[model samples]
Target: MNRFGTVVIGGGQAGLVMGYHLKRRGEDFVILEGHPRIGDSWRRRYDSLRLFSPPRYASLPGLPIPVDDCPTRDEMGDYLEQYAAHFELPVRAGVRVTRVSRDAEGFRVETDEGEYLADQVIVAGGSHAVPQRPAFASELDPAIRQLHSLEYRNPEQLADGTVLVVGAANSGTDIALEAVKTHRTLLAGRHPGQVPVDIDSGRGRMMLPIVMFVFRHVLTRRTPMGRKALAEREGHGVTLVRNKLADLDAAGVVATSRIESVRDGQPVTAEGDILPDVGTVVWCTGSGPDHSFLDLPVFEGGRVRHERGVATGEPGLMFLGLEFQFAVASGTIQGLDRDARYLLRQLRQNTVRSASRPVTVDRR
Candidate 1:
C-alpha cells in the first residue's frame, strides 16, 4: 500500500485527472487528499459562491458538470463526489502528505497516516493551497474581527459593524458585494480588470462562449498576448468573472485604492485617507501554492519552474493545476485534462526512456 508507481498529492480536479490518466496508462498510482472528502476545496468556500462558467465550462475531462446554469458550491462538491465515484479513482482521502523528499527509491512522501514510496510524484495540489493576506493586517486593533477569504464561509462569521474587504480579486469583490447586504462594506485595492460585458446580461451571455474560446484557445502560453498576460497577472488577479465593478458600484460598496496601512484604530488607504468604524477586515487578497512540504530547490521567483508541468530538477517529479500553469484556464477544471494528458505523456516517455537505459552496476 505504501509503494506506488506514482503518488499524486491532492484529490481535487487536478488529482482526479492525474488519477484518471495514470489508471488509463495502467500505472499503479494513488491520490492522497488532505480533506476527508473530495471537493472540500469548493465546499468550504464562502456560502453563496457560484461558478462564473456554466456547466459546460466548469466540467472535468469526460465528466460534465450537470448544472444548467452556473453551478453552486454544494453542487460542485456533489459533482466531485460523483466524478470520483464514477471514475473509481484510487483516492485515499484524509491522507495529508506532510513532507515530500527525493530518495534513491524515487520519492518518499510522508503522510499523517503513513509513508508512501513512489517512482514518480505529481504535486497535484489544487491552485489555492495558501491563503494570502497583508502583513499590516496583524497591526489592526485587537478588537477588530479579521478573516482570510478562505476562512470566510458566510457573513454570519462577521461582527455587527462595517466590513472592510481588501483586495479586488474575484473573491474580494464577491465577498464585498455579499458583505454589503448586511453590513457597510468598503473595498480597497487595485480592482482587477473587469470583463467588457456583463456575463449574466443578454450581451454578456452571448459573449461567454467568446470568452471561453479566448481563454481556452487564444490565451495560452504559446501566444504572445497570453504570455504577456501570464506575466502581468502574476501580481494581479484575473479579470472579474460572474461579478463586475458595475455590480459593486450598484451594490453601494465603496471602492478605493490599495490599503496603505492602519492608523488611529482604523483602516487607511493608499490615498492618505482613513477608514473609520470598520468592525471586520476580510483579506481576500489572493493565495499561492504551498510547496513548503516540497524538499526540492525547484522554486524560481516564488513559483515552481517547470516546462508545462514537468519538473526540471527532479526527473520523476511533476506538477499540475498551478494558476496559469500553461494557459489562462490551466488552473481550472476545464484545463486539468489538457495539462494532465501532457504531463502524462512526458512522464510515460521519461519512464520508458529510463527503463531502456543500460543499467550501470557500481561493482566497486
Candidate 2:
C-alpha cells in the first residue's frame, strides 16, 4: 500500500492530468491529496469566484467543461471531481504529505498517516498551497478580523465596517467589489494593469481565441516576450481580467497605495495615511511556491530550479501546475495537459539517460 512506481503529490488539476498520462502509460502511480474530496481546493475559495477563462478554454485533455460561459467555483470543483471519476484515476484522498526525502531507490515521502516510497515523484501540489501574509500582520489589533483570500468566502465573513483589501490584484478587486455592497471598501496596492477588453462581452468573447493563443504560445519560455514577462512575473499580480480599476471607482471602492505597516493596530498606507476604520482586512498579497517539505537540494533562492517541469538537480523529481512554468497559461486548466505531457517526456528522457550511463567503480 505504501509503495508506488510514481507518487503524484496533490490530486488537484495538475496531479490529475499527470495521473491521466501515467495511466495511459500503464504506470502504477498514486495521487495523494490532502483534501477529503477531489475538488475541495476550489470549493474552499471565495463563494463569488468564477474562472475568468471561458468554457472553451477551461477543459482537461479528453473532457470538455460542460458550460458555455465561465464556470463558477463550485462548478470548476465539481468538474475536477467528475474528471477524476470519469478517468478512474487512482486518487488517494486525505493524505497530507509532510516531507519528501531521497533514498537509494528513489524518494521517501513521509505523510501524516504513514510513509510512501516511489521511484519518481511529481510535486504537483501547486504554487498556492499556502496563504501568504506580511510579518507586520501580527502587530495589528486583535479586534480586527483578518483573512487571506484563500480563507475569504464572501462579504458575509467580514465584520460590519470598512473592509480594507490589501492588494489591488484581481482577487483584491473582486473582493473589494463584493465588500462595497455591504461595507465601505478600500482596495490598497498598485495593480499591474487590466486586460483591454471585457472578457464577458461579445467582442471580448470573439477575441478570446487570440488572447488564449498569446498566453499559450506567443508568451512562452521559447518566445522573447514570454522571457521578458517571466522576469517581471515575480511579486507582481497578473493584469486585471474581469474587473478593472475603473470598475472599482464606479462602485465607490476606494483605491489606495500599498499598506506599509501597522500603526496603533491600524493599517498605515505607503502614502502615510492610516486607515482607522477597517473592520476586516483581506490580504490578496499573493501566495508563493511552498516546497518546504521537499528535502532536496534542487532549490535556488527558495524556488525549485527547473527547466520547464524537469528538476534540473534531481533525476527523478518533477514539478507541475506552477505559475508561468513555461508560459502564462502554464498554470491554467487548458495548459495542464501540455505541461503534463512535456514533463512526462522529460521523465522518459531521464530514464533513458540513467539506464544508458555506465556505473563508476570505486578504487580500493
Candidate 3:
C-alpha cells in the first residue's frame, strides 16, 4: 500500500490549506480529491454563482484570489487550480474515498483506485456533502420539475412555469433572485434576515475584517455568547449576502411562510395557503457532511469528536472545515489560515509526546 505521513481527504480549499501547512513543515502528506480536476466543485456550481466574500476575504493562506472584484464561480475554480500547481501540493485527483478506518499502526484510507496507509488522516470535505431535501418532495406532482440548490446550474435548466424556492438562506436568496429573471418566482420560508448594508459599501468593507476577527477570536466554543449562537444557528442558513428583501420585492418574488405540507399534491404553507401553480420546486434547504464512510466512533451529538479540528477520542485522526469547528468562520476560506496553523501546532505536540515516550528494547 502507498504509505504517507498524512492522508488528507478532499482536495478543495480545506484540504489544500492543510496540505500547505504540512508542506511548510516538511511533512510527507497527500491530498486525495474525488473529482477529476482540482476545483471542479466550484466549476460545477451554477453559472451565475458568485462568492459572498470579496477577493480579499476569499483566499488561501499564502495565495490570494486573483481578482479585484467579487469572483465568479469560474474564477474561484481557476484560482484553486492555479494554487495547487504553484504550491506543488501533492494532490491525487480522481480518487474517491470510500471508507476510512483505524488500523493497527494508524489508519487505512480506502479509495476507488486503491488503499493508502497513513500515520494520520484528515477529513477536509466541507459541509456540502449531500443535498438535503424534504421527504414530501417525492409526493410532488410528477410533472413539476424538482431541483436542489446543489444540482441547479442555471435558469435554462428549468421548464416554463412558476418556480417555488423553499428556504430563504443565502443560496436560496441568490437562486430566488436569479429565477425571477426567467420565471415567476415565489420564495417560501421565514426570512433568516439579511446583511444591513451592501457588501461593497465602505462601512461593509470596514466591517468585514472586524466581523472575521469576531468570528475567529471573539466568538468561540469557549464563550457563552458563542455557545448560544452556535446552538441557535444550527441547521439554520447563512445571513443574506449581496441580495436583500427589497431586491426580492422589486423583482416581484412573493415571500411566504414555510411550507408545512403538500395536500392534494399542492404545497400548503404554514398559513394554510395552497400554492397550486408552482411547477418547479427548487429546494434550497441546505446540506450536511456525509461521515458514513468514516469507521471511527468519533461522531457524537451530530459533530465529530474534535476540539479545534483535532480528533478528541481518536488519536492521529483530525477533521477540517467543519462549520464552527473553532469559530464562526471555521469552515470558510478566511478561517482556513488560522485553523491550519493551529492544527499544525496540535500535530507537533502529538509528535513530541509520541517521541518522548521511552522505548523498551525487547531481548529474546
Provide the lowest-lDDT 10-residue window in model 3.
355-364
TM-score of each: 0.93, 0.94, 0.94
Tens digit of per-residue lDDT, candidate 2, span 54-151: 87787888888899889999999999999999999999889999999987656899999888877789999758968899999999999999999999
Better of 1 and 3 by lDDT: 3
State the displacement of the C-alpha of residue 326, model 2, in Å, after optimal TM-score superposition: 0.9
The sequence of per-residue lDDT tens digits that candidate 1 reaches over residues 1-364 is: 3776788999987898888888778877788999999999889999989988777778887788888888999999889888999988888888888889876656889989988877788999856868888788878998999999989999899897889888888889989988999999989888678888778788988887787778777889999999888888767877787777778899999988888788876788888798878899999888778888888878888778888888876787899998778888887877788889888888765551245434332111
lDDT of 3 by residue, 1-364 (tens): 6777788999999999999999989987889999999999999988899987888889887888889888999999899999999999999999999999976646889999988877788888856878889888788788889999989998988877789999998888888989999899999888888889888888988888878788888778889988987998876777887889999999989898998788888888998988977889999998888787888899889767888889887878888888988888887888888888887777765541244334332111
How high is the lDDT of residue 136 in model 2? 96
Error of 3 at 346 (Å): 1.7
lDDT score of residue 278 within candidate 2: 83
Clashing pairs in 3: none
Better model by TM-score: candidate 1 vs candidate 3: 3
Using lDDT as the measure, what is the rank order of every candidate, best first? Answer: 2, 3, 1
